[model samples]
Target: MKITLITTGSTADKGPRKVAEYLQKYNHKLEVIFYNENELRQTLSKCKNTDLIVVSANVATHKRASLLIQHLKKLKRPTAYAGIYAALHPEECIKETDLVITAKPAETILELANRLENFQRIADIENLRLKFNKKEIIKNA
Candidate 1:
């Protein structure tokens, strides 16, 4: 799966980086973009082939996360993944996000990895369906 990580503030980068490393171990493609909220807006168009979008809250607050959620919702991406550190629950960050994984560093990494794997499986199935449909169309033609 091609994962795009949009991280705001300094602390938020750690979790996404760790998750990216873990996913890379499984031969998955991961791109970690560390930027403030303003920077994120400027580069939002660069997130291509992004099967999943993971946002970190340690760098900011629910307010910033909310802004991200709104922007992502407009993009209408298939998979919206949100995570928060400290005492914040996933619900506080973004309601439209597909899966919310909340925990401390150690537990968060484990849970995030599991969620990514599950998302990847779903994406794989979708890809197969598209391929089969295209083959059928070609055959009919």
Candidate 2:
């Protein structure tokens, strides 16, 4: 799956980088992009087909991270927040994201990805059922 990690502040932040590295190690096929806050537009553009978005609030103000999350929400994608700020203010992060990773961010994100993949599969099955029912109705008519 394609995962985007957007960090608040510069690339000097180690928290998000570590998360990205961990994720890469977990699944080499995973396409992960680490972007700074200033690259919001580029991140949004690349997120067209992204499966998940993880925002890191390392050393930046909560307000800045919140605003970034809000912008990402407009894309209607599943978003997760991490880093110390997220851990300290999970409630605030939760307000803007689907999940807040207080610890073991890489593991939590992988689990969430699995759940989402399964959910999509279930939805596909349901759609097939609907299509089959429609065909049966047409045959009866």
Candidate 3:
């Protein structure tokens, strides 16, 4: 699954980076974007094609994360909240995102990704069966 992780604040912070690295090990495609460097339009555009989006925030970046989630919710896509802020303030994060990783962000994300992948695979098989049935019906008619 393609996953996009957005974080605000200084580049020196390693929480987001570490989460991204762990996800990559599980063969999920990851794009880590530092939101401060890009316009909101640019950030959203980059996220538009991703299967899942995870926004990382701490006390210093929670405002930015909230703003981004507001915009992201409009896209009607799956969004998750991660990082120290989410773990510490889950009630607030739950208001903004579909999923909140209150602890073990990496492990939680990996599980979610696996579930999504399995669902997609099942959907693809169902679609194929539907198409094949349609062709069979037409041929018989």
Candidate 4:
């Protein structure tokens, strides 16, 4: 499976970067791209081969996160949000993302990726919030 990690902000945060680094051990293809709004469209256009997208941002990059999620939604791709902003605002993040990843995301994201690839159950992933069904949103506590 191919995964894209789009980190958006004026300054980079450590958490998402660490998670990105950790994910490489799983041997799945991964691309970590630092995105500024100016070049976002161009960057995202190159993501045609991505199986999943993980948008990483913080409070300072709220606008970036929102913008990226909007475009990702338009593309109808499976998308998730990582880092502090998503953790702090799972409700808001879930509105835009297919998955809202809270807390440390590497292991959870790996599990999600593996499940997504193999068609295993996804709702059981730790710290991940998403819809249980179209009628209801599942927010993990």
Candidate 5:
């Protein structure tokens, strides 16, 4: 999966990078693109193969998250959010996310890595289902 991770604050960047490095051990094909708010918006417009988007809660109360959500909704890509405010402001995050995983700096990276792996697994299953359905249709045709 190609994941675009948007970092709202300096703190958010470290966790995603660590998670990406950890995930690389098991799935080297998983590509992560780190972006700050401005870069993320611009990249979103051009990215064609993005499978998922992860935003950090450091963006709390900022319009960046809302704007990104609108774009994601239009693109129909699955999204997730991770950071301190995720749980406390679940309603806000949930509006834009398929999953919200809350964690502090201590375990944030590890938790995000695990959640991303699960997301990948689910995507794989969905892809296989689509492939199987297409095969069935071809056979019947």
Candidate 6:
């Protein structure tokens, strides 16, 4: 699957990079963009054509994450949130993203990539907390 990994300047978290490496091991295409590296519009536009977008935001930039999520939500893009804040606060993250990645997420994300590639249901993937259902946000195991 083609994925766009985004992170804010303040956090500069390595989570996205690690996931990029892991996904690449499985031959998945990935593009990583740091907010400080390019103009917001340019970085965000990259997400539009990708299969999925993974935004990693810690405590310092959940607000920025929310804004980005809101914008993506408008475009009807499939997005997931990662990092400590997302895992710790799935409730809040769900309001912004279609899913929340938590725990040892790399493998689960690989499953998600494959499922997405196959046009299969991704909501039941382990370690993926899905918010697509309004009745309940699937929690991490």
Greater lDDT among 2 and 3 belongs to 3
Backbone clash count, each prediction separately: 0, 0, 0, 0, 0, 0
lDDT (10s digit) by residue, model 5, range 1-141: 455665555643576677667655655334455555657557677445666566655644335655666566667665666555564565555555455554442243333345555663332221011112212211100
Query: Between which residue pairs do clashes occur in model 6?
Result: none
User: How do the candidates rank by TM-score, highest first?
Assistant: 4, 6, 3, 2, 1, 5
Model 4, range 13-119, lDDT digits (tens) per residue?
Answer: 66656776788788878887888878867877867779888998888887788887888777767788887888888888877766888876888789889999999
lDDT of 3 by residue, 1-141 (tens): 999988876778787789889999999999988887358999989998999888888998899889989998877677877788877877677667656776777777777777777774322221011112212211100
Q: What is the per-residue lDDT of model 6 for residues 19-116, given as tens digits with 9 covering 90 to 100? A: 88999999999998886534667876777788888777788778887787777765566788877778788788877777888767678778888898
Best by TM-score: 4
Lowest summed lDDT over 10 consecutive residues: which window, candidate 1? Answer: 132-141
lDDT of 1 by residue, 1-141 (tens): 666766665753566788777767866677787756667566467564576666666634556765666677666554333455323553333244554444443344344445556763422221011112212211100
The TM-score that candidate 4 achieves is 0.90
* Model 1 score (lDDT): 0.51
* Arranged by lDDT, best first: 4, 6, 3, 2, 1, 5
Worst 10 residues of 4 by lDDT: 9-18
Candidate 5 versus the native: TM-score?
0.59
Candidate of highest lDDT: 4
Residue 140 error, candidate 6, Å: 3.7
What are the per-residue Cα lDDT tens digits for candidate 2 across 53-136? 777776556777788788888888877777777777665566666566766676666666666766743222110111122122
Query: What's the lDDT for all of these models?
Result: 0.51, 0.63, 0.74, 0.80, 0.51, 0.78
Per-prediction TM-score to the true structure, in the order listed: 0.62, 0.72, 0.80, 0.90, 0.59, 0.88
Which scores greater on TM-score, model 2 or model 4? 4
Candidate that beats the other on lDDT, 2 or 6, i.e. the better one: 6
Off by over 4 Å in 6: 9-12, 36-38
